[model samples]
Target: MTTFLTGWGRTAPTPAVLTRPRSVEELCELIGAAPGRGVVARGLGRSYGDAAQNAGGLVLDCTGLDGWTFDEGSGLVTASGGVSLHELMTALVPRGWFVPVSPGTRHVTVGGAVAADVHGKNHHRDSSFGAHVRSLTLVTADGTARTLRPGDPLFQATVGGMGLTGVIAEATFGCVPIETSLMRVDVERTADLDETLATMAATDDRYRYTVAWIDLLAQGRRMGRSVLTRGDHAARTDEKEPPAFAPGALVRAPAWAPGGLLNGLSVRAFNEVWYRKAPRRRTIVQGIAPFFHPLDFVDGWNRMYGSRGFVQYQFVVPFGAEETLRGIVGALSAHGTVSFLTVLKRFGPGSGGLLSFPMPGWTLALDIPVGQRGLAGLLRGFDRRVAEAGGRVYLAKDSRLHADMMAAMYPELERWRQIREQADPAGLFRSDLARRLRL
Candidate 1:
């Protein structure tokens, strides 16, 4: 009835039973009768860490629930839990609409996105994915489907509850109007940490989407030097012509890349070249595919991290905590961590979701190889600094945060846990993360 369990990064669990439920009823049935510590619904497994994984338990693969319908009058799209942003984008883009918020990768499922409360470059303007959600249908532990509205307290808890409350069966949210699936962007290069933050603060609001690619390998005065990319939805006049196709393309990567292929020397060289290549000022109109989901261009891109796999660490520190941000970046640089992708963004006000990850602050996300010695210790230290600054790490991207750190970061943890217990009194939905962090 079940197979093994693993995440997108292919980090296998200690052998568990995996169940692919084709419908909400099937999923509910499986969860209600699950034998182990309980069950956790898994999407496309796009989450880099164990948040979606339930070692030695039932892992419900929900990709089979991909169903969607659009309400033309309200511009609202209702999608099944398993529906992916990639699928939604392809269907909606040609119709002159876009998801209100999208993470860097489009492969994320609707359920996963809500659980993670994912944000994108536009976070400085819009906030997390949960902010746009109007309603959700959840299959509670009791096998009853309940529809939750934005104002409901349980709604906020479930938004970023990370599948702990119940299995998100369906979700309805508004879509943004767009002319073409394209973005009109401006690019700028900053010389140092202060310059980067200043530039972002100065111009972030001018663009609907904004992010900075930092040169993490740089040190001292050059520390945190970055290439800032800001963009707004492209207007009709800005586009020369409609794209020939909707750019619904997908690419896959080789099964594996050579070990140590992304070592310090290689990443440093890549970062240096990347820093130099950014122009001081430039304007470009790009397709939505390339602008929002650039990583999708290379299929199986995770292989680039090699056989050791990788973990994506994304954490946010409140505004005015520049020293905390600088300190974390400095530690990464000093450790020579070879992160292929390092992104920085300024988040706006957060949704009231108890487990929401973002707030009015600066958030940095990095992809680092898994086997780096002392990596866990380094992250623990960063966690302490973040907790001290009233910051929190994104649960969707975390695999190794300590229980005490989690409690300190999310002050409302107990509140969320109480609601979760009421919905799933027996704790029918659980994961390695939930067990490890005592959630």
Candidate 2:
């Protein structure tokens, strides 16, 4: 009845009474009678931190509620909250439709995606997952179900509410039309930070999807050197190259891999090899899987960080705050913080979820092995700088942010909190993250 649960990052593992709700009725019953620590929903457990974990409380695992419907004429998709994006794509792609927006991985549940309001490479063009959603069903603490639509205050809160408002039962969202699953990709390597920023700024509007793999270990003249990949769904209508189905992990890491395996030297070497491997300028046709979800190929790749787990630090600074972005990247290089994978992208505009992370700005994400000396202090310093620049960290990937910083990062926090309290006045919807950051 009790199990130890941790986020994808494997940090702050906690024990909870985990329940799998096979139906909306069952979920409502469980929530109405949740234990003292309160109730929260868990999807595939893909969140990097404690957003879905309810220590010493009840956790409703929503995977069993899988159900979906599609309308060919309008490209509208209605999927159960527990249904994975991979499952959705598996069905949609063959029908010549694709998710308008997707995070790096397809393993995320539709509910999880809505709750996080995830952004992808297309963010510079399409905004976030919440923007495409038409309506959603919410099962609140009081055992009632409500169908909320866009432009509703409660709907805005639930979009990125992290499940505090209640359990997301289902979502109806618009899908994009695609000729094929293949992408016509253009790759170019930038010489330095300024070049990388300028290039993306100038040309990003030309592509539907774009992202940069930045070399965080590089310093001096080579600082922020990166390989930029920009692409759009290929117009190739060849039936021979049908869209791909959901892909499985190409390989899985051992559970017992040693920790601290990504030290500075190893990371530097990896970055060096990765940078050199990219062509200076090239064009290629790639599958949507490889181009969007490369990390999905290596199952349990998180294990590579060793038993101690790793921290996924992602933050965004508004446009014109380029100075703040430069300072943070420079600081990381100086600290020799070993980040094996780093990404940089420009966001067009936010979906306006009260607590959504993306805005019209430059966002960067890094994977850092935890337990490094002064890692906490280093990240906190970065947080202060981001806050001062009118920026915020991504809640879905956060583990150590201070509660005091949330208001500054999100100007609409108090308004969102008011809606949340009105929905679940007794605070029946709760999680470790809620407690940690006082959300």
RMSD of each: 1.5, 1.0
Tell me the TM-score of each prediction against the true structure. 0.97, 0.99
Put down candidate 2 lDDT per residue, 1-439, tens digits, no spaces: 8999999999989999998999999998998899889999999989999999999999999999999999999999999999999998888897889998989999999999999999999998999999999999999989998999999999999988888899999999999999887889999999889999999999999999999999998999999999999999898653357666667899988877887788988888988898899999999988889999999999988889988899999999999999999999999988888888899999988897999999999999999998888899999999999999999999999988999999999999999999999998999999999999998
Model 1 bad stretches (over 4 Å): 243-245, 248-251
lDDT by residue for model 1 (151-204), tens = 897898998888899899999999998886678999889999899999898889
Model 2 misses residue 99 by how many Å? 0.5
**Against the unseen true structure, what C-alpha lDDT does each candidate score?**
0.86, 0.93
Ten contiguous residues minimizing lDDT sum, candidate 2: 236-245
